[model samples]
Structures are given as C-alpha cells and as structure tokens.
Target: NSTKPVIYPFNPNFITDYKGYKLGMSVEELDKLFAFRKENKYVNSAKEFQTVTGVSDSLLNAISPYFKFPDWVNQPKKQYTSYSNNKFENKKPIVKVDINLATQEDLIKVYGIGPALSERILKQKESLGGFVSMEQMQFIWGLSPEVVENLNKHFIVTAEPKISKVDINNASVKELAKFPYFNYSIAKEIVTHRSMNGEIKNIEDLTKIKGLPSEKIKIIALYLEF
Candidate 1:
C-alpha cells in the first residue's frame, strides 16, 4: 500500500497576484508590491512591507507574521559597547576548498551547499573528466551566481584534468557528440566539415562552421585534440 507523505506548512511571501485578494488587501496596497518588484527592490521586513503597501494596522497584524526575509536581513542588529567594558569577539575562519579536489564532504562544509548540490558538483566534475578552470564551474547546471560567489570564496581551481582528449579530425560523430558540449548536430557538422575540408587543423577552424559560434569553440576545444 502506498502512503501519502505528510505535508508541512511553509511561509507564503507576497508572491502571486492572488495572495492580496485572499488576504483582503486593497487594490492600491497590492499594487505597491508589484510596483516595488518591477523596480527590483524587496520589502525585506514586515515594517517595510507596511511602509510600501500602506496597509492598516489590523491588516498589517494579520499578514506580518507570515512575512519571510533572507537570513542576512533576519540577522540581529549588532550592539556597540564602550572600550572599557568591551566584549570579547570569538570567530572561526571559513575553511577554504580546492574546487578541483573537493569531495562531497568538503563541498558540504561550505555554508550553502547541501548534499544534493554537492553531489551535483561532483557529478558534473566527473562527467567533464574534471574541471580545467575555476571559471568552468559556472557551467554546472542550477548553480546560481550567488552560490558561485560563495563557492569562489571558499574554493580555488588548483588543478587541470589529465584525461586524454579526442583526436577531432578522426573521431566519429557519435563519439564527438558524447561530449557534454556537443550535441549530435554539431558533432555531425564537425565530422562532415572535416571530411570535406580534409582535416581540421586547430580549434579556430571550428569558427568556419555555420551556426557553431566562437564561444562553443572554447568549450568544445577542451575535449578535442587537433
């Protein structure tokens, strides 16, 4: 017998257009959030939400409890003390990681990366036959720029992959397509061009193929040897 998993309650921020209507907000009040969103600004606190929306106290009280903010915004404000009555500061330095060498455990030790994302990083690295540059990490699917910044703070690319590259002039289309950067169409184009032109002399030759852009030459070059 299949059992349904228990669903837990989650915070609902003023996300969709429906929430304001359901919560009994005035059209003018609801429009404020949409206007703010259009400007790419956020009402990070309940007070800020009220300030933006001009909601009455009763309405503010009803909705304020459900307002969710980012962790940085939620952090308590620091209090200053006199030098004579100084408080001790205790801190632990964040450990650095080598992106090329980090295991799942090491990846997880970074604040934001959980098990699934760590696994994905490792899997992408493995599929790529290991990363050739720190910049290459940007290509990992689902890694946001913010997380990439965090990863960069803690990690450095110290090594390049030692795997053998394909002989592009001789490799079959299917073999070339097996590489992550090349789909069958591009691979077929490469092979057909090589056959017609006699041999692909270097990565620059790929730029001559129609629809295969120069940016692709950089990525596809990683797996190809002249």
Candidate 2:
C-alpha cells in the first residue's frame, strides 16, 4: 500500500518547472508559460493560464480547483453608486488651457507631474519655441501614458507657435540634427539622401529616406520646409 502525493492550492503566476511537471503540464506548455512569465506578466485566471500555455481544457479543469490567487484577486468588486443631485451641481466645468501657454503651476496640477517634471515640460516647450501639437508631449522623458492622458484633459493646442522651419532640402547634418525628433545618425541619412536624390518635394519624399523614423515623419514635417 502507498500514499498518494497531496496537491496544494497555489498561485498559477508563481508556477515553477517542477511544479508544472507535477501538474502534468507538457514541456511545450511549460515553455509557453515560462515565456509569458519572463515578460513580467502574470496569468490572472485558469482560463488565462490555458490561453497562455495552450493547455487542454481537461487538464485545466483537473487542476483549476486547487488554483489559489492573491486575496485581492478573490475580493468582491465594489458596487457602483449613483451620484446624488447635489454632488455635481456646485462643481464648475474644467476649462482647458493652451499647452504652449501652460505654466509650471498649471502643469503641476495634473496627477503624477511634480516640480521637476513640470520644469522639464516647460523646458521642452521652450526648446521647440512652443508646442505645435499636443502629440509632442509623448516625447518628454518620464511622462507616462496615464499622465499624458491627464495632461490632455487639461490642455489643448489652441495657439500655434511661430516656428523657424528647417529647409529639409538644403539643411546640413548638423542643422537637421537640431530638430528634437532627429538624432545625428538620422540627420546624416537625410543629408546623404538629399545629396543622392534631388530636393525633397514634401513629407512623402522624407518617408523614402532610409533610417528616418517613418512614424515621426508627420511630426517632423511640422517643422520642415521643403
């Protein structure tokens, strides 16, 4: 007579190679799971685990009962509450300010933006003469997507700044490199392309330049005069 190995509840997110083998997961399935985990992601549910590892439904069903996630994952979601009539009656509507004109004080009001970040934003704004588009906000170092979204809610590009547009056809590598979106390598590529080909006619021509960031061609076009 022999005793059977006892299966214990465990978080699928923390599965090890040995643990996966004990759960009867195939080497291929374990590899897939390990790959997903390597990306610093977690399998939130048994279904998600199967989706990530391509485990069979039968195998998932067999082991799902013993799967234990964190208490936060198991907690019941709070019920949504309806707002009272007076809750928003006294609140004033938000008036968006021009991003180009927004001061450090104004920028600091947004969540996640501190003094240093606000100063950086102001510096970036000043460096470009002023922001021609709100999209430029994404280029600011340390600005997260969530903070960008918040910034968008409180700012707009109502005022367009007067910019000294770069002459893409005649600008040297050093001159082209001055553009915020471009680096020395990209600037050199542009100069080389201009020398090989005739004058760059328009934004479409800039796209043909090898090694130029195709995604930022539109933004770069904003500051270029062909």
Candidate 3:
C-alpha cells in the first residue's frame, strides 16, 4: 500500500504508480500517465493533467499543488490579452523592482516567471554575483524576448556587483575557464596570448582569441579587470 504524501512540491511528470495511488489517483489516471510516458509526452499544467488523467476535480485540486513542471512548460503567456481597452487598461502602475536585489520569491510575482524560471534567473545572477547591465538578461537560456520585455516592464538593473576578475596575466587557464562565459579552449587561448604578447589590456584584446564568441565580448568584459 502507498503511504500518504507529505506536503512538498514534486514534478508531476515524475509520478510513478505508487506515487499516483498515494495521491488518490484512480487506476485509470495512472494508466493514462503511464501510456503518455511510454509515448514520450508531457502534461504541462494541472488543468491539462486532469484532462489527460480523467480525474475528479477534488483529486486534481489536492494533487495539483505539487505538480512541478519543467521551466518552459509552466511559463505564463498572454494569449487572452484583449486589444480592446477595458478597466485593466488604466489600472494603477506596478511598483518597479531592482532585479539585482530581488529574490526568487520576488521574481515569481512576475506574470511569466514561475518557480522554475525564477530559480534559473537567480542562478544566472548568482554566477555573476549580480547583473552589471540589463542587457545580460539575454544570455539566460530559454527566456523568450517577449518574456524578457515583460520583465523589463517591472525590473531594472539598479545595482552592480563588485566583480573580482580573473587576472589572465597570473591565473591559470582552468581558473579563467571557470567563468560561465569562458570555455576551456578560450581560456587556454587567453593564457597563450598573455604569455606571447602581454596582459590583456581591454575587450579588443579578447576578441583576437579564436573560438571566443564574437557576440559575447560586451558581457564577458564585465567579469574581467586588467
């Protein structure tokens, strides 16, 4: 027999038969989930999970609270936004956020950023200590331009991290590569250039390294000092 579930969040896609049973899912529902998995498909939301599993509303309400989805699936969208201006067209302005200081909990309040996306944004921020510029938001994987624009509506980069840079003149290739922006290959190239030429003077110096992404010079520049 399956024991009752303690209150905690879990990915609904990972639900096994025992987990389903304990969560009060019918055999039919479990079968549907199993079949869906065998076909390599997914259920994105609580509403969709109910539709697929044919569960009662009561069961769905109880189980849905724990249905964690992959970041892409649960990102809220604006499909129903009315072009016709109504009461909402002239509502009070939202309080703006300094994104550098905002926590995971604060990010979740944004329409598109659910728990998963919030963590992703925070994780990326933590890697760089904090954002040096709002433009760096583009580097975060899976954040759509529309979603980014929505974030910009309320959030701004009001603070900058005191980023301690890898001194290419003295640091090893492994040390330089530890920055998310630099790969081992590029890190090695930077070190080689430093050995043959001298200390990398500026962003222009980094561009001379092959395999260093041409597009990333601006963002990469932020994480380095002399």
Candidate 4:
C-alpha cells in the first residue's frame, strides 16, 4: 500500500514544478507563476497568487491556508505625517526653465529622459535653432506622451530663438526641404504648386498644395514668410 505524501506549509513564491503538480495546479498556471517569479515579483497574498496564476476559488481556498508568507507581508504599512508649528515657513517656488535655454543636465533631470534621449533632444533643438513651442517636443522620436507631459511641467518656450524665416514663394524644393517640418516630397509639391499658380501667400494658400501635410501647415507657417 502507498502512503500519502505529507502536506506542509510553503511559500507559493518558491513553488517548484513538481510541487505545483502535487498541489493540483495546471501546467499553464505553474508556467504563469514561474514567469511572474522570473520578473522578481512575489505574491504576498492568496488573492494576488490567484490573480497571477488564474487559480480557481476552490483551489485557492484549499491551498491558501498552507501558504506561509514572510512576517513583513502581514504587517500594516506605516504612514508619517509632518506638522509644522511655525507659521512663517518659507517654501521656494518651482521655476520653469525656457526649453531654448535648457542644458543637457536640465533635460536629463526629467523622469523618463536618459543620456541618449537627452542628446537627441539637444541635437534637434540645435538643428532647429531652438524650440519655438512646447508642441514641437511631440516630434522628438521615442518620447511618449507621458514623458512630453512631464517635460512641459519643467520647461516652457518663453525665450523664442532668432530663426531666419524662409521665403516660401522664392525658395527652391531643396531650400524648402531644409525646414524641419518639410520633406523632399512636400517641398517638391510646394514648388510645383507655386509654379502652376501664383506665389503661395499664407496657411490657406498652402492648403491648396496637393500632398502637403494639412495638420502641420500651422507649424510650417511659423518658419515660412510669404
């Protein structure tokens, strides 16, 4: 006659493949738990374990009683509150810096920016003379909307850089392509339109040019003169 295997208290975080089989956990559930553990995360509670492994309620009830978590996991987290008796506490106000004047050090201080990204931002700013608006930051590759939002919190385009505006009416396709917003194709289209019609005057005139980016007409307008 075969004797029964002894059941003992265990940490679910350290459950091995063989041990998981004995606990009646499916292969997929065990794989999920292992994958979660590979990320260096631990399930501190039975509910969390079920969440990670997708275990049934009955199995969770049967196994959870035997789950032995560390003492710290069971303790309530402490909260500290600050109370000041001084009425004349001086707090320094946060000052937003001009993006045109921001250094590499300043750009990297924002949460999502690293060395490579900071360098790219500086290069783009240098190429464009300097950023004219916060909206221009959206064009920087690899910057997520959240990162851009964070950048807006710390930087603003207060000091406009001195940029020589291009004459759209007189500029060649190559000359027009030099602008940050225009590509070779769009530049060629502008030149073709100017040749076919009279000189392109304003944003409304640009809308008539086929293959021109309608959305960027406003931004492109900033760097162009009639």
Error of 1 at 140 (Å): 1.2
TM-scores of all models? 0.57, 0.62, 0.61, 0.58
Model 1 lDDT tens row, 1-226: 7774432322333456666776778889888878765543556677877888888999888767766666644442222123224333324456666687888888875545768879988987787787776666566665545567778888886756686787888889888887776778988998889878878877678787755746557866776788
> Residue by residue across 100-202, what tens digits does model 2's lDDT show?
8899999987766779889999988776778888887776776755677889988999967898888888888998888877889989988888788878999
Q: Which candidate wins on TM-score?
A: 2
In angstroms, give how far residue 87 of model 4 lies from its true place: 19
In order, what lDDT does every prediction score?
A: 0.70, 0.81, 0.77, 0.82
C-alpha lDDT (0 to 100) for residue 60 of candidate 3:
85
State the RMSD for candidate 4: 12.8
Task: List model 4 lDDT by residue over 1-226, tens digit each.
Answer: 7986778999999999999999999999999999877644677889999999999999999889999997645542221112323454325444799998889999987766779889989998877777778887777776755678889988998966898888999988898888877789989988889889989888899898877667566777887778
* Model 2 regions more than 4 Å off: 1-90
Q: State the lDDT at 5 in candidate 1.
A: 41
| Model 4 segments more than 4 A misplaced | 1-92
lDDT tens digits by residue: candidate 3, 40-109: 4566779878877889998888778877886655433433244324776549687788888888888876
